[model samples]
Target: MTPPSDPARIPGDAPDESELGRIAADLGLDIGAQHLAEYRLLIKQGLGGYSRLDELTSPPPTARHYDRDPGYLPGPDENPYHGWAWRCSIKGAPHGPLAGRRVAVKDNISVAGVPMLNGSPIMRGFIPHEDATVVTRLLNAGAEIVGKTAVPAFCADAAGLTGLEPQPSNPYDPTRLPGASSSGNAVVIVSGQADLAVGGDQGGSIRLPAAWSGCVGLKPTYGLVPYTGAFPLERTLDHVGPMAATVADCAAMLEVMAGADGLDPRQQLDLAIGSYTDMLEEDLRGLRVGVLREGFGIPGVSEPDVDAAVLAAAGTLARGGAEVMEVSVPLHSDGLSIWSAIVFQGATELVTRGDAIGANWNGHFDLDLVDFYRRAKPAHPAEFSPTVVFTVLFGTYLTEQCGHRYYVKAQNVARELGRQYAAALETVDVLLLPTAGMKATQRRTDGSIAQIVARALGNMHNTAPFDATGNPALSLPCGFSDGLPIGLMLVGRRYDDETVLRVGHAYEQLRGPLAVQPPKLADRR
Candidate 1:
């Protein structure tokens, strides 16, 4: 007789009960069996539902997490005063202007009283004495944080949800992955759990998730948002940006978070250039948007569905009187190494400095290190996988040795490309392109080399360069394929966010009212 089929198993489903228990144990949280079942169901629906930011719009039980505090509670309550844990003390005061606005903070960032794991088990019980500079800015501006969101085991995993990590379930399909290291934050906002979410992008962390989840994410030029009191990723390239249901929402969050903080010694020390929030509604009647079609048409990329979405969005811009032109970026496929180098350097620093930060990694990481290598690393060092030591470690050595030369070359190329694209933008309001060549990869049940690497490549294609260029980019849900949402990326020249945002706002409005709700789990309902 054939073996009985397992009801609990979904091909490539991640974090089984045993695995979930390990994560819970590592964090010292009590997760009930019922909660796990609910979470699993939520995960399954998320794969099919929330990724497009269509799910979770309507109230549902799967939206609540048993292991965490109440997230869906309605209120205009202002949250967080900056260093990590939320200062939910302002419940009944005059509703902050952003009172009704809901937000989710990337877990790696500081939120007072909230335990920021930094995606590492090492910082398990950490509670910052103060808020991150960005957090304080949010509260003062009246944005209410719905809750702290989850991240990959470390913020350095550039593959986003490429498949190897235990961190977050891509809301689109439980069978597939959500791009990470900023997993939870993106899922929540796109699922409509919040109106805005702030994500830190060092190597495409914010943009990857935004692309996968079909929302708007911005990686402000480095130093736009103060990093004071937040855990470090590479001190050099670390950036804090906004993740929201719309580009306008992200702009509002940026208004609060952008600025140098006296407390953070590493702050860029540059004067804040007025408010990013002020630019959200700027006119975009005539602007130039560049379409870098190079590498976009490569195999495993520019899938038919995404290509159509890109063209469709570009058409939308043309209809609005903006000019669109095709351009090329010296960004080769091998550019992942450039991103990997910066990312690995930061992870290595955090892993080494765990003790200094009073972090919580001992139990989870020591075990995970062995499991990660076994599950994902290629037998040959050249294979791609986000969690493999070979990937991260090798990147460290490359960056240490040849990083400067490559960075300079990359920057020069980027400058030339920017100048070229900027010229196009002189007439186009927003550049249009498939935010990523492929849809989010299917979730990895096994975390093998093949699964992980493929997903990472797909995750980084459209969003990474903007990080290096320090240009403002916007993503809007253009359409869907096989039920997964695809995004239209709008790249604007440095500090031209207002122009890009107005374009995004106008697009969002043209797309019509986008109100999507999470799939209902009858048991929870």
Candidate 2:
């Protein structure tokens, strides 16, 4: 993702007083002309100090070769599905758990030599020279790296459409969104292009896409899976997990990707987790499943059929011997606002600050992002999509103008939300809800930036709170509404990913496979 060049700015070596004034003005600083020129010289000297950072000292490309990058566009287009397809075969163990599995990674995760677009034009040519921790784990488990998938710019949108890359479409209907941020990962899975994909979720990225695409997506317990290597968006909210065709497959992928990588600070070294796949049994006898009351009733926003379908799925689990009951967490309703404050401020901090604020277990930072933020000044901010432009502006304004007061308040409220969910989990093994209010939405061709923000924000109502509270959440296709699939989310106690997976697996078995298939690839078999 290469930042578009701005002709008005002075080149790195040649610092112009006018350019410094322009930067200071954009930052809302009020410095006098004499001091400003001195400041410009100081800034130029400081910039000179970073010459070493610009040099790519990484070792040679690790993959077999630099492969083809199919552009976004479905049918006769280099990339028909807007799914970035490349071939990087780094075969691992001959007889590992994931042997023979074809896997796609969301672009945010480093693939060592593969260009990580992060679904933005800003990072276009930046190729990481080292594999992300999950990539190494996947290869160790014998999964073949098929390629990278499209992501929303900075993983901010849940629209499944990249602002600058190919807009990923629902395989069932090209007019519909494919589920976002992890849009390309879901696209490849439903389109039968890959067996599984490793996706990162800060909000509902993995699950949202999985639901729309009719696949299983899991956001592993916070810290259960290492976050080393993937780009960060709100450190506390970040999660990396697997999206697969089935619950069992997803579990297997998680088994391989989970556990402490030593480099991921989020992982608790002594945390004990069981074999998630083994927990998948036909019977849910005696398990208590709480149907979250607030999960529905979004008034005009939530579709009745979608809620009914999820409720029915819970009832099916009840019939299989699980005790189902309704539970209320009042704060659950405020998820969107809380998530927005925390994420916007935190993301703004990382984007605007030269370095990450939190502990870096992986000993790595996105120097590329820092480079972009400092230099990006196209006349129109040319390469940024309306959605990204909106996010950056919103985040930066909130961070700078409000001085992060909302961010602090959001974190305080988030703790209460976590406590509320924890208290409910004490009585119930897992909480269930409609993964989202509606099924896959039709891609809007005439949307304003406001509408795009609204759509993306709407998709996260049910999923973002868990990110804030650091819970294990999973989204699986419970049923279909109209011709598109609907997702049912199961949230478990922090560090209790197995319970969530078990409940989801049991429900998956009881409901059976979804009848609907992505229309475009239904005949692929």
Candidate 3:
């Protein structure tokens, strides 16, 4: 499908510091301005923020759903981003139950008339003939798809620095990148642009963005939500999940997103989940919850706030009558590497699916994965960001060369990790851990290599293994650092989402609701 069309854009090549500063100023993004300056200095000093850059780019949205974001009025004069987006303020409107409940969707998933822009420009203009199984479920549940979110070309890197869709800037500090492919969705959710959003997770696509943006993200038991109609990242690992302001909200959305669908081969995965929303009230008491003390974690960045918040949240569960124990997974290193291979495997698939050159997809991005989608498309080699294109090109070769072997190894790692995780459940019905080591970072126009490692790897540090084990997992904001949300992951045994949901909801209520709101458009406010 063709990526959506939009008018905003950054030049194809990486912009200089001065240029980045100018862009930030125009948009009133202070954080971005600072990062651009710091980035310039670092480049001169031979330093790098590859991870930061990677986080900035990512699962480039298939189309810029919000680039030309439509404005709305609740009382004759209001901006969409300003008031209606805030959950607490608008939670009880005409949309009542979900009245005014605005949501954004990742382009990888089907949304009927909406196009699935999986980050490659090749599919431009290709709109889905029907709503993805998940979307139809959402409509029946009362939520609305306000816009489609951007991604990093494919569901490849969660940092979503794919630089497509005029990448959504972090609201708190525009300099920092909103962890993505579901980048904009998470940002809008946190910044009060949307109440909840539909996001897909292959590695950390959903959770990382949620953690980074201080929202709640969930990847239900694999088959709980059908994969039919959603673009593939890795058939085995891809999930259509929910991103929301709170755990209860996610549970509500999950209620509708899950059901049997004959069209999906994976539909065989639909187990009998009685009531996802009902599962929310399950007690945390007598729940065996585990804490990850060693191995399998986001590396490089040292985020004190993230660590402190996650620990505090875990302690909160203990205070709530749950027995939280410490645990570790086997072959953590091997497991992570194997997952990395999986990322390359899926991304290469998305990139190679087409032969088109640069073409516009979302509101602000024209992603062409044939070469490199980040940055503006260069007329030739000189215009390309060497590292970005090289990563994709080399990744294509690597997936082709080592993917099968890695797949076997990853399967083993999945087995080993699952066994250990399952054993941990003996003492704790659920396991808790930091979703990512840090909050969101600055978004950049440069190819963000480290962001990939931080996001894809950091998130999977505690996640992926579950995908391997076919178990269920959930992430909720336990607390915040500097007001930005941090996630507390709840991992459960295979097909045990019910237990996880109960514990998650109990803990989420204790944490209360998020209190952030988007700014009223200048004069309107």
Q: What is the C-alpha RMSD of each candidate to the true structure, in Å?
A: 16.9, 4.5, 15.4
Candidate 1 — what's its lDDT? 0.58
Kindly list the per-residue Cα lDDT of model 3 for residues 1-525, writing each as its tens digit.
Answer: 223334234333455888767777876677655578676665555423443454475453323221222322133243332212211111112333454566667767665455555554544555554556666655545556665666665555656555344555665566666676676677667666567788887766777777776677887777677776576656567677888877778877777677767655555643686576776776677677778765324556447777777878878788888887777655544555666665554445543333322123221222322223222233223322222354467666765666556656666667776677777777778777777666766554444655444443444565665555656777777766675666777777776777877888898777666555434233232
Candidate 3 stretches with Cα past 4 Å from truth are 1-100, 295-299, 346-392, 399-403, 444-460, 513-525
Q: What are the per-residue Cα lDDT tens digits for candidate 1 across 1-525?
A: 111222122344545777777787876789987688677766766665335543334332111111223233122222111111222322212355466576678777765555555654344444443466677667666666556666655565654542223445556665656667666667666555566777887667777777776677877766667766555555555678888777677777776677776545445566546565565455445566667666367565678888887787767766776666776555444444555544454455443323223243221112222222223223323333356354456555755676556545655665555566566556655566766777777765366755555555446766766665566777667877876777677777666666667777777766665444334222110
Show how many residue pairs clash in every candidate, following the order shown: 46, 10, 56
User: RMSD, model 1, all Cα superposed?
Assistant: 16.9
* Candidate 2 deviant stretches above 4 angstroms: 1-80, 85-87, 355-362, 366-380, 519-525
Q: After superposition, how far is residue 151 of candidate 2 from its true place, in Å?
A: 2.1
Candidate closest to the true structure, highest lDDT: 2
TM-score of 1: 0.69
Please give the lDDT score at residue 502 for candidate 2: 87
lDDT-best of 1 and 2? 2
RMSD in angstroms between candidate 2 and the native structure over all alpha carbons: 4.5
TM-scores for candidates 1 onward, in order: 0.69, 0.85, 0.71
